[model samples]
Target chain A: MKKTTLFDIISPVMIGPSSSHTAGAVRLGLLAKHIYKNTPKKVKFTLYNSYAHTGKGHGTEKGLLAGVLGLDVDDRRIKDIFNSDIAKNIDYTFSYADNFKKHPNTVDMVFDDSMFVSGESVGAGEVAIRKINDFNVKLTGRYNNLILVYKDKPGMISQVTNLLQKEGINIAFLNCDRNAKGQEASMIIEIDGKMNTSIEDEILKIPDVYFVTYVEKLEN
Target chain B: MDTFEQLYKECLTKNKTIYQAAQENMAIEADISVDKVRSFALKSLFEMKEAIRSGLISKELSMSGMCGQDCYKVQQYYKKQNSMFGKLFEKIIEYALATSEENIRMGRIVACPTAGSCGIVPAALIAISEEYNCSEFEQINALITAGEIGRIISLKVALAGAVAGCQAECGVASAMAAAAVCQLRNGRVSQILNASALALKNVLGLTCDPVAGLVEVPCVKRNPFLAVHAITAAELALCDVESKIPLDEVVDAMGQTGALMSPMLKESSQAGLAVTKTGLKVQKQVFD
Candidate 1:
């Protein structure tokens, strides 16, 4: 069973009209921003289904933009984020689509025409970052995570786990997906301890490693 | 941790009230002190109060011009004539509207279980606290009890209208409020649990059928109605009324009911009130 804290139920003071559409959108954006690791010059947001239908009234667009700009969900500026100076610094656009295959409240944030992060507001104020780029992954932003894209190889998993074990870090969850044998693969590791640049650098040192990014947990 | 039965057992064995057990367990899970847990609840409590304060005076319509004045209208009505249900009833209704309207206007509010149902717990707890002159610490304890109720129900079903319809969102919020109000009134642990059970048992299958797919219309008005619904549960529980079925069983039934419900009624706006003629016209006016 998932261990839900008391604070999870009663808290997360936020600007809202809907948790799934508004606050949850901000969280999805925050996770996407963390995965991207840097502010992109432009972002294209494709809102799906319910998010597409009622997103404007719920301020889903504003929440997504404000989050990418590093604003917390409770930030009052989210209501008028479009007029904020921070929003002016970046180029962003919102497009709508209907995909019954996707979660009702799903969004894809494409940054600078390169990185694609798709997430869904799973209900309450919780969200899951389901896809980063083309790699299918699961991230709930509940723990410090290390995401790596590398060539699929036999020793990749052991190599990564060995490093984490040496550092006395506990792995809460880990998922690795590859398109085919010995092809491009993605590793998503949720850890119970803190993460730093040194740990990320060690993962990058491994041969065939293509990309590495550390995603910090979202604040409650 | 998964069931209210376990929570009751833990509380009994540990000689703690529902809030005490909940706070201690959360403190251990989050690796924070129990005081820290209380402090977090306290912060949310203050924010809830602030939302009510801001909402009470503002008649500003939402971006869609659908809601945001109902709270003002209710306040005016109450000023001219008191509710037959009394001042506590009037306060709960007025505060629930204020907080929910504030939410539609993009104002800050504590998402008790969820933003759509944020008003219920605050309206019930704050109104009762004021009526009875409860202390801040007592109010926090009541709030924590409410949180535990929500947290437990959420374990069985995700508290989202899209997931389990409004039964999980506003229905659960009403249950949480019942638990909080029961605790405030010095009810026993069983009574508090029973209060929540009554609330949940009664609101099973409440659909998430907001008109125009917005959190207005039924969503805004539903807050006050459910807040009052919570009081009814608390009143019954305080008088030693039992829910026949256990709280855990009620939650199980709710989960099953949500699963059997059609997808169209689960925040999709394809059925129920969302697709009514007036609902369709409003949708066109707002979105087109």
Candidate 2:
């Protein structure tokens, strides 16, 4: 279990109405932004279950858009993000759905129809990115993460861990997913220490490694 | 660190107050200085006060039009007549409503435990501090004491309405507020714990059924009600009244009760007041 701190219990001074719906939505968008690594020309957000039903009143849509545009959870501009100048550059639309299989407060961010990042607002303004396109991944935005997409091959995990070992960086959690044998695969590494572009550059140099992104932990 | 019993033992052994023990423990857990922890808490305190200041003057309705003018109405009422309970009571209710109304209006607030129950702890702690002329340092101590209470309870139960119910959100907030108020009143460590236990044990099984699934209906008004509820527990504890159940045991029971509760009543908007006749109408009005 993750350790609960006094800050986790009493802090995160944020724009409110509902923590799971509003603040968590913003976090999901922020994480999605980090995972995407850049802003897209267009994005479509699909809110599911409880988020679909009550998201508007709680400003979930605004939160998601504001976050995608790099707004923090506490930014007062989130309330009118639709009219904000920063939001003018990106075309955004929202669609609602009811999928019982999905978590009650789930959203899918389709960026430029090229990247699909699905995340859930898991109670108390905490979130977990569950899927990135076709690959299943787990990202809580708690620790700095190193994400990689590559062709499935033997020893893909060792090659990555070996690089971190050389750097004296500790791996806290590692999750790997593949479509099938010898097919596309993805790796999500949650590390205990800081990340530098040098590590990401080295990972991208590995054979069959197509993508690499270093996501810094969210600043609360 | 995981249970109130352990926290109590540590406090007794170290001969420290709840805030002292809590800040030290948090400093170690978070790997930061005690001063950093207090500074973060002070930041939230200032935000809470700012929310109250902004909310007290605004009468604008929330996006759903269900709430937002309530704090203004209360302010108006107090101007015409004082509350039967007196000045402290007026401050508590006004502050509670102001914070909550600000929330639905998409204003800033400190989610003490959560945004839904954001008003409870601040209203109780801030009101008492103002009424008693407590120092900023004393207020920080009380706030840390409240955070410690919530953190311990959260170890036993997740402090979210979706995970447990309102019992875990507003219920836990009230308990935290009771502990904060008790600490501000200079109650002993045992009495502080007793105050929280008294608050938690009474509000067990409280459902989280917001009308139209919005935090406006019961959530906005419930803050002031529960803020006062917290004071009752503090008053009782300060007078040497004790809960037969220990604080840890009460939290355990709360966890059990939440598990036994129907999912429909756990922030799903499927049963209870969320599905009432007017609830359905409000839902349609808001969504359709």
Taking all chains together, each candidate's TM-score versus the true structure is 0.97, 0.98
TM-score of the candidate numbered 1?
Answer: 0.97
Could you give the C-alpha RMSD of every candidate to the true structure, in order shown?
A: 1.5, 1.0
For each candidate, the DockQ is 0.81, 0.88
True contacts kept of 2: 0.86
| TM-score for chain A in each prediction | 0.98, 0.98
lDDT of 1 by residue, A58-88 (tens): 8999999988988999999999999988888
Candidate 2 C-alpha lDDT tens digits along B22-84: 999989988899999999889989999999899899998989998999888888989999999
DockQ of 2: 0.88
The B-chain TM-score of model 1 reads 0.99
Model 2 residue runs over 4 Å out of place are none
Best by DockQ: 2
- Model 2 TM: 0.98
lDDT of 1 by residue, B34-76 (tens): 9999999999999999999999999988988989999888889
